[model samples]
Target: MIEVEVEAGAWTAALPDAEAVAARAAKAALGTVEGDVVVLLSDDAAVRALNARFRDKDRPTNVLSFPAPENAFPHLGDIVLAHGVCAEEAQVQGKTLADHLSHLVVHGVLHLLGRDHEDDAEAEEMEAEERDILAGLGVADPYAAEREGRA
Candidate 1:
C-alpha cells in the first residue's frame, strides 16, 4: 500500500491532484517489490531539516528516501518531497509539476527498494528502470535534456 500525506499547502495549490499523482507513481515503482510506503509532501524548510538531521546536509533537496530496517520486512520506508524544490526543478526542466513529482516519487521508492545510483553503471541501470516506469505512466524521458547536453 502507498500512503500520501500532504504536509504543505503549496502542493495542493499547485496541483490539486498531488496525492493521487504521488500514489500512482509509488505504485508504479513498487512493481515486484513488496512493501508499504509513506509519502510526505512537504516544504523546503521541513526537507532541509530532515536532510540536516539524517544526511548532515543543511540543504533542501527535491526528494529524500528513508528505508526501513530489514526486520521491518513488508513496511518498505518513507519518501519525502519538497514542494518548492520540486516546483523549481520542474520549471527548469520544462516539465509539468505532476510529471516531475511522479519521477521523484519513483526515484525515491526505487531507493527504498535498494536501488542506488552511487556509480555510473548503477546510475545507468537505475535510469533505465526509471525511464521504463515513467513511460508506462505517459511521462516523457526525464533525462533527455541531460543526454542532449541541454541540462
Candidate 2:
C-alpha cells in the first residue's frame, strides 16, 4: 500500500494530477518493495528549509527523500519535491513537468528501498532500475543527459 500526501499551494493549478503522477512512479519503484510514501509538492523555500534541517544543506533541490528507519513504520518515507527546481530542471532537460516529477518520485522511492548512488556500482544498478521502471510508464530515462557522449 502507498499513500502520497501532496502539499502544493499555488503550484496545484499547474499539476492537476500530481497525486496520480506520484502514485504511478511510487508503485513502479515498489515493484518488489513494500511501504507507503508521503509526497510534498512545495516551493524552493520550503524545500530549502527541509534540506537545511535534514541534510545540512542550504539550498533547494529538485527532490529530497527521507527514509523511515529500518522497520520503523508501515510507511517507506517521505519524498519532497521542490516545484520551482523541478520545473526549471524539466525545461532544461527537455522533459515535461509531469514526467520530470514522476522521475523524481521514482528516484526518491528507490532510495527508501535502499538504493543509493554513493558508489559507481551502486549508481549504475540504481540507474538501471530507474530506467526500467520509468520505461514502463513511457517516461524517458532521466539519466539520458549523464550518458551523453558515452558508448
* lDDT score of residue 43 within candidate 1: 99
- Residue-level lDDT of model 2, residues 1-151, one tens digit each, is 7776667654567778887888888898899765677877888999999999999999999999999887776787888899889999989989998899889989999998889999999999999999999999999988888799474
Q: What is the lDDT of residue 148 in candidate 1?
A: 90
Superposed model 2: Cα runs more than 4 Å off: none
Worst window of 10 by summed lDDT in candidate 1: 142-151
Top model number, lDDT: 1
Off by over 4 Å in 1: none
Each prediction's TM-score versus the true structure? 0.97, 0.93
Per-candidate Cα lDDT values, in order, are: 0.97, 0.87
